[model samples]
Each structure stands twice: as structure tokens, then as C-alpha cells.
Target: MDEYPFTKLVIERNLTREEFAILMERLEKLNEQYEAQKEEGLIHFSSLLIHFAGMLTEKLEPDSTINALQREGFYPSLMNEFIRIIKQNNKG
Candidate 1:
């Protein structure tokens, strides 16, 4: 599938919705800790959080996606825009 490592893990592990949500929550917590501590790895954690958030969007419905992101402590505005773009592209 010419998959990158991240995509390969996502596709191959086949995590359930609940499992994925747990993973998201854990990542979010770590990201927050990095930010609060002003750790050098904050950048990497933020990037991973963003990447997982994108994957989460594809795995969830609009409302569910919003709820999931909110639960993970992300602001929803950008995600809403992303959802709109994804829907628009899918329509074409």
C-alpha cells in the first residue's frame, strides 16, 4: 500500500473506536504535559497529536468527531473546517 509507518500502524493495528479514543486521550495528555513543561519534545508531541487528530476525523462522523476532539481537549474550529473540506471533496 506504499504506506508510511504511521499509516501502516493505523491500518495494520485496526484499533477499535474505543481503543482509538483511549489512544487519543493518552496522546493528548502527553502533549499537554510537554507544553506545560516547555519540553523540547513539545513540537514532536504536537505534531503527533495533529496527525492522530486527522486520522480521528476520518474515523468519525462530524458530531462524533467534534465530541471526540473536545474530549481530547482540542479546539474544534479547525477540525470543523477540515470536516467541511473533506465532505466537499468527497462530493466531487
Candidate 2:
């Protein structure tokens, strides 16, 4: 099961519903900030995601993280969308 690094980390963390909600809220805010300033905001958002993924990776094994993320119904779609957007932006 292919998964983005950040998505795998999130799943490995096994965040509670509330935790997931909070994370989503933070991501939303980051996205809004990115929209406000495309260059700097994207840098900040990417940094945040990398940091979060690193934190989670430190807490669990890679195989476990992949398994957990695969169980999450929404993660694949979200991660795929993120990958698509990143690729699209990079192409320009």
C-alpha cells in the first residue's frame, strides 16, 4: 500500500478522533495561510508536514505506519491530492 510519508506518520501515531480533528484544523489554517502567500506559505506548510512526519516516524516503525495508514479511509485520497498538487505546482 503506497502512502505519503506524512500520511503514514499520521496513521502510525494512531491519533484519536479529537487529535485528528485538531490536526486537520491546523492543516486548514496552514492551507489558508499558503493561499494568502503562495511562496512563503507553501514553504511553511511543507515544513510543518515534514516536521510532523518526522515526529511520528520517530515514534513507530515504518512498516507499522504503512499498515495503519492503509486502514484509514480518507488518508489515501488526501495524500494523493497533496501529491498531485505538489507535482502540479512544481511543474510550473
Candidate 3:
């Protein structure tokens, strides 16, 4: 496969190339929707990314990979920002 960081990361986590491709295709669609309606679609894009990450890590022991991600300060960081953005938008 290509040498993109996200692709490599997902592959390292046990997602096959085919599964990664499928997820990429779905993410592309979500990106398009988010672009067309930026404010309204940010949550969808962020949520999809988080869900894809969870799916990619499914082969690992339950919550093991996710906990590592949190410890390493990756997904949890983004999740916090996404939640804050969602809450702020909801308030306005």
C-alpha cells in the first residue's frame, strides 16, 4: 500500500488494506458532506473518524489499544475538542 501515516497506522493496528480502503471511501464521502455544510457536519466527520479508529483497533484486546491512544494523547484529545465544539454549537 501507499506510505500515508494514517494508512500505515491503521494497518499496524490490524486492519487489512481492503478494510482501510473501504473506511477511506466512507471518510471521503463524509468529508464532502462536511465541506458542503461545515458547521452542521463537523460532528459527523469527527464522530466518523473516532468510530473508524475504534473499528481499526478491534483486533486488539478490549480497550487496550484505545487506552494506549488515550495515554499517548491522541484520540482522546481530539474527542475532547470535538465534544467541546459540539457543545458550544449546541448552545448557540
Candidate 4:
């Protein structure tokens, strides 16, 4: 496997339905997380890295992934999206 392909697949494999759901639930939050990291003075590259982090997160341990986000200071960003996604999901 090539590096990029291998990595993407490896990460995708770890994603749980809930995690994906959570991500979908909170894309705005994800975007916000992106902004916060930037505003917090995490460089642009590091800010962009949040997406990679999200992918890695989806592929790795779910709770741990969220914990890591919290540790890195992404929770607030994720809040809006979480609420949106949750409400959307509930309509069934």
C-alpha cells in the first residue's frame, strides 16, 4: 500500500457509526475547532491539522479521540455541530 492510501484506509477502518455520526453531528463544531486552534495561536498548519486529527480520530479510539480533542481544546468548536447533528438525527 502507498503511504496516503494506507493511512486513509487504516484511519477509516477505525471509525464507528457513532463517531461518524458525531462528526456529522458536529461539522460546524469541527470547523469551529479549526478556528479556535488558529485563534489560540496554533499556527495555520497546525490549525489545518485538525482535519487530519479528525480523520485519525475517526479511525482510532472514539472516546480517546474526543478526549484528545478536548485536550487540544476542540470541545467548544464541536458544540454547535453536536447540537445540530443530534437534533437532525432525532427527527429520524
Overall lDDT per candidate, in order of appearance: 0.49, 0.50, 0.50, 0.50
Cα RMSD, each candidate: 11.5, 7.4, 8.0, 12.6
Give the clashing pairs for model 2.
none
Q: Which has the higher TM-score value, candidate number 3 or candidate number 4?
A: 3
List ranges where model 1 is wrong by over 4 Å: 1-4, 39-92
Worst 10 residues of 4 by lDDT: 1-10
lDDT of 2 by residue, 1-92 (tens): 24455465666677666666765675456445545655553333455345435544244543344344435543454344345445666799
TM-score per model over all chains: 0.36, 0.38, 0.41, 0.28
Question: Stretches of candidate 3 above 4 Å error?
Answer: 1-4, 39-92
Sorted by TM-score (best first), the order is 3, 2, 1, 4
Model 3 score (lDDT): 0.50
The digit string of per-residue lDDT tens for model 1 on 1-92 reads 33243334445557676767776686566445545644553322334335545545344434454444444445444434445555665799
- How much is the lDDT of residue 55 in candidate 3? 51
